[model samples]
Target: MNIKKNEKPQEEQLRKIYTPLWQNIFRGATENQDVDILNILKKVPIFSQLTKKELIKVSYIIYERKYATGEFLFKEGNPGSAVFIIKNGTVSIEKSNKLNIKDVYATLISGDFTGEISLIEDSERNANARCTTNTTVIIIFRHDLFDLIAREPLLGNKILKDLAAMVTKRLKEANEELVKYKLLAEVKNDH
Candidate 1:
């Protein structure tokens, strides 16, 4: 169809009117305030000491992932390579006995974190992490963390120190539990 020099085609007019409105709606949906990565990072112990600028840098290297209820985030004996900070929902840290019966070791909720062992070493997971509800997590892969450290040594040092402290604390707690269990076993054996 031929159009007058002063009049736009019907399709062209519709495109001009709808494009900006669609763009705004799309942007709003994708950039919701609840997905603020820096704020989420601040709640995590390893990232608590970071400055806003540093957190922003760290945020660029990390990403968000979601899991459905009953989904396993990682299984015991799987190669672990990333740390996950719970942004929303609950996860169960479970261990399987010799008979393959799973026992829940801990229930982690939003603002809690897990998979920290993967940050320090390349090893198999010691327990399984399964989503108890629809869950969202901030994941930081080992390679990304190393890259961040290489680029920002000061921030990296702080994170490494914090991670070490967390690991030490967890080790102490685990040791205490082991001693308690051993004592219980000894008492039962004597009976």
Candidate 2:
């Protein structure tokens, strides 16, 4: 491949890598336009960066499972394998405290998601996810996601970038909360 004198190879490579995913929509992509799964995925932040064409590809690797109320999606010590996106229903993100009391840390409703860590690493789940109501969730297993990446690196890059951003934002929020609580405790001690 001959590089034009005016263009740097690195710049050309980046342009290919960063080609807009939304171009398909402007070009009248009619396929998968009406699919319910595509509509559901469009709202998810992880997949929000994808074009309809890329989303149609994602729809291929997802599994929809319905869980009964009180059923656990995954336990705290279990090896994480999938990211769960709630289609419709309530999910409780629970953690057991040092006193062995079960605490519901977060309640996620329709269109919300969790378990993103599983996609980026072979880590154990830090908390348990239980359905507070009969729930339908879209599960994207790591194996399937990796397979997608192997087939379409661009789509995979977009997803991984989104995952990293989500994790970073959450970690920052957690750190800020910890600082606030520590300050509160120190003030109480001073009094």
Candidate 3:
């Protein structure tokens, strides 16, 4: 890069203006400390209903983590303790078949979320979540959720309601798929 005698470097210009005053307040907050969490959370359906203030409160309890390609986010039958929202890259949900082969149930992309059951209950995970590509995920642990609920009951209620709605919607879709598959099988049998 060539610069004239009177010209300031781009980095120097950015350093002077891009640093916000609030960044100083949150210094040393967390390993992946960044300001984009609220924007990310707003895109997730389960958190879409929350107001800006509620989302800001929730952001404090969330943490961001990265996974390399081929890393397992969580294995099936493992005890669940946190919910994950995909921030970047892809994740594959897989289950073991009778032949012991892993069959991919779904490929989730950015803006998709999983592990919600862990947030609401103590059941084991039902599927294996593996990173298909280098991925970034935002995690909300059960303990943090509990703390949020204790501090803000109304926000907690809204979150729970939204979560329930998402689960119900998924169940309905699964039921519809089952019906279609059953109808196809019956047709095949008739022929």
TM-score of each: 0.74, 0.76, 0.75
Per-candidate Cα lDDT values, in order, are 0.75, 0.76, 0.75
- Clashing residue pairs in candidate 1 are none
Question: Which residue pairs clash in candidate 3?
Answer: none
Q: Write the per-residue lDDT of candidate 3 for residues 1-191, one digit (tens) a residue.
A: 34455745543333333232112211212223233777678877677789999999998999889999999889999999998887777788778868797756666666667787888789999989999999999999999988998889899888888878877765675566567657756876899
Candidate 1 lDDT, tens digit per residue, 62-177?
88899999998899999999988777777888788687877566677666677777888899999899999999988889999999998999999999888888777656755665
Can you write out model 2's per-residue Cα lDDT over 1-191, one digit (the tens) per residue?
Answer: 46677976655443333222112111221233224677778777778899999999999999999999999989999999998877777788878878787756667766667887788899999989999999888899999988998899999899888878867766675566567657756876899
RMSD each, Å: 22.2, 17.2, 17.3
For model 3, what is the error of residue 1's alpha carbon versus the real structure, in angstroms, after optimal superposition? Answer: 58
Name the Cα RMSD for model 3.
17.3
Give residue 13's error in model 1 in angstroms: 73
Off by over 4 Å in 3: 1-35
Displacement of the residue 107 alpha carbon in candidate 1, Å: 1.2
